[model samples]
Target chain A: MGGMKKLINEPADVVSEALRGMGAAHPDRLKVDLENRIVYRKDAPRAGKVGLISGGGSGHEPMHGGFVGLGMLDAACAGEVFTSPVPDQMMAATKAVDTGAGVLHIVKNYTGDVMNFEMAAELAAADAGTEVLSVVTDDDVAVQDSLYTAGRRGVGVTVLLEKIVGAAAEEGRPLQEVADLAKRVNDNGRSMGMALTSCTVPAAGKPTFELAENEMELGIGIHGEPGRQRLPLAPAKEIAAMLVDPVLGDLPYQQGDSVIAFVNGMGGTPLLELYLMYNEVQQLLDRAGITVARSLVGNYITSLEMAGCSVTLLKVDDELVRLWDAPVNTPGLRWNA
Target chain B: MGVENFTNWLRDAASTLHENAAYLTELDSAIGDADHGSNMDRGFAAVVAVLDEVSFESVDELMKKAGMTLVSKVGGASGPLYGTFFLRFGTALAGAEITPATVGEALKAGVGGILARGKAELGDKTMYDAWAPALDAYDDAVAGGADLGGALAAAAEAAAKGRDATTPLVARKGRASYLGERSAGHQDPGATSTTLLLESAARTLA
Candidate 1:
């Protein structure tokens, strides 16, 4: 109700100051350009390798920016909280990371993000003659009527897409192949989210929306965009069923279909609840005869201190599992580094 | 009018946005991510700053610079949509005489850029909802032998009506569309801002 009890010193400086802290904290792996709001892999521009870049608004930490490293994204442009990055930052990132092999953009299909990236790509091609390929992720199952809405909102699958496609690019795959792989990951992934509370934008200094004490919003998006419905507060298992069923149905994951099941916390929810939700999710998938080939649980993509969780089911094959298992070192995610 | 008129329009719009920032944010909070007010205010302030330092040789150059400033400074659907509007508006006005018909053409061209960027249709509960009506009003007034100020005044009035019309229609574009039926009762922030810019033009451009 009063000034948001956030750790930020000023509402305007949250994104920049956070970048400064990120720079200091992970100097070995990342080089933060505070002025341009770009986080780069320290040893970027690896010749003969296609560059990988993704970006969106801030508040969803360890995504886009945090994924920039050895076997992941080459660069990420950070925007204001819940706002898309402007073309200037994107243009610079595209130019900075483009080795001769060209650069591939992994964008989430939000209106602002899509348009700004399109303008940046147009500018890059027109002025500098740089080759740029873009694949926008629209994997959320929340938007039921895609014919009436702005397709499906991109949610949790973006994290998986960057890692998988980033690994493909690290194999010296050409731009077209890398782009196609990113798109493939996008098409195969499906996500559904639910929020227990609303998040406050720093400048707004209040909750973006509200929910009654005994209510929760289902089909939520990352930035606190309202989901399909609000229902009475339910238990962890019931909530998990609500989140997982839509994802399973949307992609129509058949029996014997193996998948990477991810149970992610919205920034405010605790890890304990996520793990509990994961158990329910696994049991549901088990009943459906779908095998959980791989699993990730935690706050990989999140809204700002919003209490909720999203379930993402990526129908994966051996190729996806292998790429996702590739060695990677970054601040937010590191495996077999 | 010359570049000074555009400079004034941007400055005036900046003040208006700053004044109404909280209201816009409130509207967005209902159906969107609650940053439209701040984004528009920030983008227009940048445009005003550019006007203060850079002297322009032509109205087209001035408008193009404003568009580039908004594109570079603002981040969101508003940035590209408004930025493209100004850019195309300026492009259409290059070296042309400032007649009522030419301004109407420029307005249409600017709105066209918005449609191309957003891909939103009428009754989509977006800025285009306000724009479609405003454009029609501008043409009708121009055809009725109205002066430039009178034509823009009519357009601004129609835009206001369209902005009010967005309150009951469900959103079909942008972040608000995610709410589906829940988005119906909230006035679209983009449409509200579009009307503000048109009203500012009525006050300054004419």
Candidate 2:
């Protein structure tokens, strides 16, 4: 098979070089810890304010690391391509970003991430007396067997949670309140993903997983895992039906219930396709009688350069809607703040 | 285990990771995202660098420093998992010369630390696959009157077998677990590196 195409100069240096690029690009807002592989806001640990930190594997750009700035994560630890960051990096991040107001870790519910973040929180508590609270996001509806596989993969809602919770932290909310808000976002959201093609990790110099040109995987995870079902290629409207049906079915979203509909691209997909998918998604929600309160369409959480998309719908209330509208400044999502 | 021996083992482990990083990444490429080798290599090199700066009066101090270095330097899952193993293991040792009996206790503590942190059981298809059997092998060897070196060697062998065994099992945890049954047919990179760690311990401590 032919090698996968990448925008990077060298596959081996993707993570480190990307950090350098990000540092050079966003000098004022962020600082990259080359040795520790952490990205922290320039003004970190705002005194007596809760610190929010999140991270996961690389390849999903503008995620945990890119979102580190004002009204977002205090620190973002970058792991290798699609792998969870280790404990020490997390510990340092927790310590670095803590300013007597305590620290909160926003972990996506991958097993390694949960485990490593848990260890880091413990170490921070034992060593520095840093009060650390971890709230895990498992908003993906693709996986039903919550008893295993760390429940479900935390998908796009995590991005929304980080923003909402970050604003609360900036407003000096206590750790408990911040954590509670994070959980609310998690509970209100459900996402399902599908992939048309696989992505390549530079270090691997090959595709992480394979999908036939005419075949697509549904209910797929972000790490290029085979989905719940593999079916022949279908029209965008049909694919939208496949993706949105299960999410709606599982959540029992009633008619007139307000929600934030997010149609996310999985890296390789273009805006044209995402917009097309979004239009289809809106129609499906209309048919289901679910009211769309707010809508975001973009590649917020991606699987490298895979040709795919995931639909995340957050059942929103008045408080979350206000939080969502609040001004925020981060590399990935920038608003008035 | 003496400080020098432990440090040397760490150095050797680092070297092995650096050399076989591509191989490890290759395995991950098949079923994972392909950073296992590089992440482990980067983390361990930092660990070796720490060995020179710290003065250790006992095994606990040495292991603690190693864990700290790994946590701080390594960016990926291997760093935290291995770092926790050493930190918890060192805490269990608590400033003593490690005897076979005490080392067994230390290993058990490290394994438990991983379990508590990762929440992965036997069939989770993670680094735990290698670690669980290695601890069991260490216990069995000690009970059979094997010396520390002999027991570690047995443990290392068990770890390798366990690592290979991950190839057929469906991953029930971690990122690979996201693949469900498709995660089978590829050896787990975490388990493979874990076996190397045990091998390093056996060679250095012996």
Candidate 3:
């Protein structure tokens, strides 16, 4: 299998060691709480400001944690391998990150993530009196039964929402504004993913799931869960259609609609494949009479070293376009106005 | 169950997790990410470290300490779910001696905490699937005038059955649920591990 290979002391120690590495890599910008297994911005709990927190599993590197800086998340709770971070971690993060302005939880739509964050919110409300507002990101269109799902699985747009909503919060936007903007992003975005090969979780010391050599799983989630269906591997254009078509078809991105198109790699896939897929996706969008206002092509959110990609389209307005262009600095992505 | 028996049960449970840490992760690999065993091992290790420091004057104190330890050490869904279980259990047993009826009450409190925390119904293909039925069986066993060990053993058996039932379920919650239909045909690692916990209770408390 041409998949992820990592160097670590043991499968069990990856998260803790990674947190330690993060602390060492960016001491000025980040703080690692070994006790709580949480990553925090060094100067967090910025007085009188709404603290933003998000987290899930460990493989989606530079996400919830790496985004913990200026104009992004204030703290992120790290869970086991691909499991959602528990309520205690969220509660700890919420309390540590809270100021007088309340705290916001940017949760992906997964049962575990939602439930854990909910419990944290309850604890924060009862014990600490910390005002907590949670916005769930469910941009993935792959999962059909929304009622059966813990809702939709939050995918690529989460990274975008974190940035946009983080900016709003940084500008001292009220909790309600930041929350509403997050909801707006959720309402306007849709995503679909595919897996070329399975990802090997370090702790598992093996792949959690499998994929055949000639086939790929469609509508895959970040955890290497098999998608809506499996199909023979095809050309990048066909694959892009497989991904973008569902997202666009589900939402019907129409003429004159401007979108933020994101082509994200699942991890093991190279940048070369990502660029190729992005080109194909762009062509598909153009053919559908949709205009691309902003585009990002890379592995912003990943599932270990799974070989695959996902496409996310967020219909944009003037305000969202401006926020997308705003200056922000984090480990995974950076831009200056 | 007396204080000594409960303490013994707790220690044995910790040892079981420690011994089967890799086994738990192995089960996780089949259906979920492979960390349940390790997470439980880490949490219980912390519990063991502070076992001596806890005041057993009340069951609540010991359980509360265990819950906090798991929260501080374990970082995944199990941490919060199991931690909340202990926390609510402790609250239920506050200022009380350990007894079969009290144990049933604590189990109910734990199940309630899991429900409030996870929002899982009986068939969500989560640890709640095992826990909910186990609590119900524990209640039935107690009401039928079963002993503590017998009651726990019944609960453990039900949990094992519940865990086995998840093999064919379409998961509706957690990471496995994202798999949808693909999530079927795999025994839920969380539920399986939860059954182990009850089994330990049955064995140690017996």
Best-matching candidate per DockQ = 1
* DockQ of each model vs. true complex: 0.89, 0.47, 0.49
Identify the leading candidate in terms of lDDT.
Answer: 1
Indicate the residue-level lDDT of A92 in model 3: 90
Task: Categorize the docking of model 1.
Answer: high
The local lDDT score (0 to 100) that residue B67 gets in candidate 1 is: 92
For candidate 2, give fnat to 2 decimals: 0.57
Sort order, lDDT high to low: 1, 2, 3
Candidate 3, residues B55-121: lDDT per residue as tens digits? 4766688888888777656766787788888989889988776778888888999879877867777
- Model 1's number of clashes is 0
**Model 1 per-residue lDDT tens digits across residues B1-206:** 77788788889999999999999999999999999999999999888888888899888898888999999988999999999999999999999977789889999999999999999999999999999999999999999999888999999999999999999999999999999999998899999999999999999988
Overall lDDT per candidate, in order of appearance: 0.91, 0.85, 0.84
Backbone clashes in model 1, listed as residue pairs: none
**Candidate 3 chain A lDDT trough over 10 residues, lowest sum:** A203-212
Displacement of residue A232 (Cα, Å) in model 2 is: 2.4
Score every model by TM-score: 0.99, 0.91, 0.93
Clashing residue pairs in candidate 3 are none
Q: Candidate 2: misplaced stretches above 4 Å?
A: A9-12, A27-49, A86-100, A170-172, B52-57
What TM-score, to 2 decimals, does candidate 3 have? 0.93
**Predicted chain A of model 3: TM-score relative to the true chain A?**
0.97
